[model samples]
Target chain A: MRLDQIRPGHVFLLVLILGATLWYLLDTLDTSRRLTNTILVVPLAILVFAAGAFELIREILRARADPTTLEQRDVDEDQDSDQTPVDMLRGVVLLGFTGLLVFFYPRLGFDLAVFLFIFASLVMLEPRGYLAKAAFAAIFTLIVLGGARIILPYPMPTLIL
Target chain B: MLDTTAFSGALALLGSDINIWLVIIPGLMIGLVAGSIAGVSNTMAMAICLPLTLYMDFLPAIMFLTAIFTGGGFGGAVTSILMGIPGTTSSVATTFDGYPMARKGLHNEALGVALMASVVGVLIGYVILLLVVAPLGAWVIRLGPAEMLLIALWGMSMIAALGGNSLARGLIAGAFGLLLGTVGMNTAGHIRGTADIPFLLDGIPLIPAMMGMFAASQLFTLIGSGYLIKDKTARRADYGKVLSGFFQVLRYPVFQLRGTLIGVFVGAIPGVGSSVGNLIAYAQAKRTDRDSESYGKGNPKGVMAAESANSSSEGGSMVTMLALGLPGGGGTAMLLAAFAMHNVTGGPSFIDQNMDIVYTIILGNFAQAVLLLFVGLGFLAIAGNIVKVPITWLIPSVMVLALIGAFAVTGDQAGPITLFFFAGLGWLMKRYDYPVAACVVGLLLGRMVESELIRTWQISGGGELEFFLNRPVALVFAALLVLSLLQPAITNYLRARRARQQD
Candidate 1:
């Protein structure tokens, strides 16, 4: 199989599964060599690892025999087949924004962090509706914050209420 | 099986208390709102409200709690149908077909169908509980570890059906989930994959993980879409369509009955409740239906099957809690706490002595189920407007809510962090054609399967084969599992043979 036919995402996921399975299996065995501890973990992990290996090998072989199959596999009708580089970038940006939101949530306070995330995400997703987006973001944040304060038993950190 | 004395006493007790009837609507409302929220669970809602019940009489308190239980069952479906996110674990399978229907501009119908099925499921469940709560409770207690393990295996079998064109990818995803599920400490007091994180001691927080996988992952994939439904005209919520959808469930009585029965039996098992019931019901529906290929794509029957099973599970679970004092799941656990608060103990003795109260509870639930029809209709009218929102706005808003919910669930950063990690993992799995649902199921059943296997082993003294042979119930389940596994192949062979004969 040509290297070009191998989808890096597919390979990466398979390897991650295999690596995690092996690591977990080894960890369980290391913790205790007892039959009870390892009974479910050992067999299941080995099976997963083998399955991951088989899938990887099968994909490679399929790629060699039929390149079109690999291409066809990636094309889902529900998932936009025409996903441009710009759309890809948007997805990445959204993902990064979410990660940042989570990272800053406790630090910035739930209310402020959520407001900023929503505002920024709206601005990024909808180009012409900045004022509307900001208003919606602020209002939405306040309402949810108010509800959270009332509903949640424990207090959350907040910059402003 | 009807206790004549209890029946008359129950009727008198219910008639004497106007307060009992008064709490039902409010309890259902609280439950609906709680169940629809991404992070808030029915147990959490009930737990928060448990103290309020302390001031009330016993019947009213139990009725209020049960009202919440009933409302929450259907409430979870609102989010599951409207958004890809399941409001609670019970509604996971609802999202499989319900969300697809929403995407296809059938949100109203989907919601309507879910509501009707849930109502009918509850009614049927209560009817069964009324008739067989005594014997059924006795039977459910007889289920040993072997049976539980087989049930877990049966749930795991769903991974094959969900694999979506690639069995290997599906199994790999499921196994990966199983590994993730077993990440925390084992039953033997050994920690395997915690990486020294203190919170991992209990295992990955399930609700946060679920929100990340199903909701966040789907949101990420919808980055380019303008709206949830492309057809603007179809996006409007119509009462007519909803009523039509409600009536539509009547056409699939057999499927509804099957799902309801599965829900009751599965939900009766402690620790295994509506979540597994819905999956089992959905799997059976998919396996048996002629249009099985349309299941995940947006078959209303799929929604009916899932809703009926999950809703009916409340009844099934009630049987255990009422008869054996064993909580079937978290909601019932809260109910048990309420029972304690009232100085009421549930068991065979409780059933024998307080048969009137048991009948009262069951009869009260019947009223709650019927009242839910009208109350839920109003709730749906408001909830159904979700389709009109622009995808761009909805995406960020939902993601934020989900993160907040995750935070609420874990009471710390762990929830949001787990959600973020799983979201990334889920997106990758989705992109690579792996079924995230299978993985979710695996994660859910993983710990249970392991614990049960260990128990089975201990009981058998390491002679599992011999022990399994002795378990008639286990043997029956084993046979059923084999049949379920081979059903597709058998059906295909029969079809092929018929085609050849016709030729």
Candidate 2:
């Protein structure tokens, strides 16, 4: 329950998953109480939420019990905090650019969207030699277009998206 | 069961097909490249390539898809070894040791061992199929919904995944996954967790979600690194090491044979496929090894066990499909779809009537296994260069390909959206030390679990729980489930008893 005990990643997931589960459960109030609704979805969702919630409680409680040697549970094993500002910006930029690409993808078509996404992503990654990056992106685009046209059986592998 | 007529018929089928050869190499390559990509699976590759089979005859069509399935078996292993990312559910267990080996600069040997084990595993599975498919088919059919439920439950118990890190954490992850899986719908046509989103009515897009969780999240971990392989010498891509690793599989005969047996039997069960087979095979290997301490820390035997079982499951799944009209897993499900497209039926009667055609498909896959050895080497030699790519470029480029692949699956923004959502979820889960493999397994089996539970309940005479009491196969599975559930406790008790006796 203590806010200090939780990490940002956990907070994000707990809020997202719990919010969605509750939102769906509440939406069912408009419908009839069917077996699938009650016996299946409600209990399963609650159990999943409870499982995650329980783990958090256990961590906090265990941390409190061992007060003699305090260890901060703030570090994510996969994340490295000691980084240049540029390294941090690369992640943020890559994520934001991908979101934009996904949003624009419906209108631009697959080829244009993917080409732009790749080019922008490469540039944002701050690769050396701008011309080489552009050429690399162009070659990758051509290969993708060729593969989509010739190999895949879909009628519009690139065009549909 | 092989009459002279059927033997000659199989020979004629093989001799008459030039189209078969054309599709074989392409299909294998497609499966390999796609499966080796972090998030894309053999099933996804097979699904995309399934339409190509429509233009061919029935036997060749079956052969082509199975070739892809077979090649993907190893293709997935390659990525798992070199990249610390499992290419598919089956390759999840491969990472327990394969990735460790890669980190230790043993990636070449790991890849070679995986390839060798897969080739041998596929060969063994078909050999078993050739011998006992009729009898095995008949027996496999006797397994009802209850048995199927037990099989699914058995898969759910693969919580000792990633080398028994933390059983509690694994179970929580699996439970969380199963919940996500049951989100979209119930058999009664009610959408459960759509939250008024129409796109979610079909449930979460599995492939995209999987791509995000496995590929994107793992890429995030390597964001600051320069290359996949840290050692300078390992980056050279030596064929000599590859050959040595290929032969190293011979040194682990016990692991190979045990994994092969486990693969075929578990893989033959409908609804459970190599996803369970690879995990169970790896778990068993870990449990029984004399040098168990070395298991999760770069053991070649672990790679062999996982790769062998997953690849050979191709034969195992084929047995279930051809003889029972049931899909053994996702890959077999695609094969069954091809069967329908070619206007061919699969089941007991299909085999009885077309014994020659059945044998022909089996024989064709055997040759495909031998060809996989050569083709895999050529493929790996090129794909191995991925480790040399700078991490910054690698992450974004691969992520883009993964996004495109996701789009290709659902043909809409739903795919890419799901991919990103799951990638974030996967990142959080990974950050918090939950087993993503357990979650993926749960997602794969959650719907099946619900359906079979409903069927069991309905057939139990309006909620009478005693319906399972009289079924022999169900009883056997029930017993096995109990034993599996108690295995750790039982082992501990025995170990304690021996220690007390020594005192």
Candidate 3:
């Protein structure tokens, strides 16, 4: 069967969501011993899973009624084009850069690494003109350092340069 | 004598201090630019610019900040007219007719109308600020937490009133936001959603959360749509039509006056700010106008009504902040925070203690407004040019600015990281037919509503329903909420009756 017709995507999403919810629920319960508070994550996870289950069921019914409807359409539309895996992967990569910066800013230092991260991201987001990209990266780095690094309450990361 | 001396002294100070004007000029320009860009917000502009204020003395600092405030409020209309997208929540009302005007090739005329209305609004709001700051402050200080709670609920109810078409979904989104607010630690010393993340212990970063809900979400959705925003190179309009459009405002004084009143009243309410005021004023103007059917179709009146009230609300909001030590909007809240940093209290006593300084700030509102008028018109011309810049250059630059602004706020990469994640989440929510604006409204009002409900419940010894029922103000607000929730159904029935009569 085609993946969408069998509702594999829905099933996969639901199960993954359920697993994450269950993990969060268990983690909260485990942590609650030290803190006396309402079990918020428990309710949240339940709701999310329940919503996912409902969605999966609805998708299956639609698939059974008209299997052809499950087929992915042409990606010509402006709205659908961005939802493609390429764009998602771009976001994933950008977010990964962000995660790396967040976790290791103190070690590698802020000024050098952040500029590098931003430069890398810009090139990835728009790859063609190296000169234009470099100009953008340099201007962006200066503005952030000038505006934010100068005025913020917290101390800026120590610059090696 | 007090008035003349205050005015003269403030004027003299303005004349002597060229440095203040320099700061004001740049601040106003930034405000205009921020307002013109659809995804860039005035608050974000101000927040990014706020660190610049720390070094300057209080007067110059407040002057620069207020200039940003005034300029940003007026700037949002530029984008709304040029593009269908509104730069700020206040500009949402502008889009009803402003975009339609642009589509009809009266973009310059619509912008001229927006600029004039914003000027009038600033004047009206400031006049009220001049006259009522002391008395209003005195009266509001006497209000307990119970009263504060009622006011907050009133603000939240506007979501149902303004949500248009999908009211239930909006209400649900708002409820969800309220629920999320309760996730963190309460004033009762109980932790709810700590989840081993110590960073969230002080509660979800309010500004970051707002940035996520509105700014990030919008960017993500825009990125996802992948529709390249093609730049148009239309010739600039004749100066005569634009000038006459400016005077067209006076012909519709009722709209201008009504919107101004709504803006001022709503802005005066502590915690409700100009964002909500703009919506309420625009809705009221639409509901009352003779040409209600022409709304959302490029009517100059719609732009006038929204821009006027949106601008006017700032003055009233400032009155609440100065007089009552209560913030009427986010920027004012940040100002209050800044004041707290300096150990200065706001209210009647504050004015009595530092009347000269308070008057300076109040007078600065007038200066900022006048400065904004010149700045807005000039930028409306310039932004028209900037919008023509290649998307390849423009989009990356905006993304970079947004990234830098986000980082500047926290000085940690967490801000930018949060920015992208929220943007993606925002896109998903939009894709899935979830109401992003309602989710934002929910997030915005969540803490106020939760804190109030909690406070009210505590007062009633854990009696939530009884507390709501017993208080006269609360009961009235609850009744209003019910009425607002039922308005869509009520309007639908009325529409049907009108249709039958026509047939």
* Maximum-lDDT candidate: 1
lDDT of 2 at B287: 67
Rate residue B440 of model 1 by lDDT: 91
Pairs in clash, predicted candidate 3 = B96-B296, B97-B298, B137-B323, B216-B423, B273-B328
Model 1 regions more than 4 Å off? A1-6, A58-71, A74-82, B489-503
Docking class of 2: acceptable
Per-residue alpha-carbon lDDT of model 3 for B164-272, expressed as tens digits? 3434334444445544555556555565555666656665554444444444334333433322232243436545656767898988898898788778866777666
The regions of model 2 sitting more than 4 angstroms off are A1-6, A24-35, A40-43, A55-68, A72-89, A153-161, B1-27, B37-61, B84-89, B160-172, B286-299, B326-344, B462-465, B492-503
TM-score of model 3 relative to the true fold?
Answer: 0.74
Candidate that beats the other on DockQ, 2 or 3, i.e. the better one:
2
> How do the candidates score on chain B by TM-score?
0.97, 0.88, 0.74
- What DockQ does each prediction reach against the true complex? 0.66, 0.39, 0.21
lDDT of 1 by residue, B356-393 (tens): 99999999999999999999999988888888888889
TM per prediction: 0.95, 0.87, 0.74
Which DockQ value does candidate 1 get? 0.66
User: Per-residue alpha-carbon lDDT of model 2 for B37-131, expressed as tens digits?
Assistant: 75567787888788778888887788789888888888988878876667577887898789878867788888899999999999999999987
Better of 1 and 3 by lDDT: 1
User: Highest DockQ: which candidate?
Assistant: 1
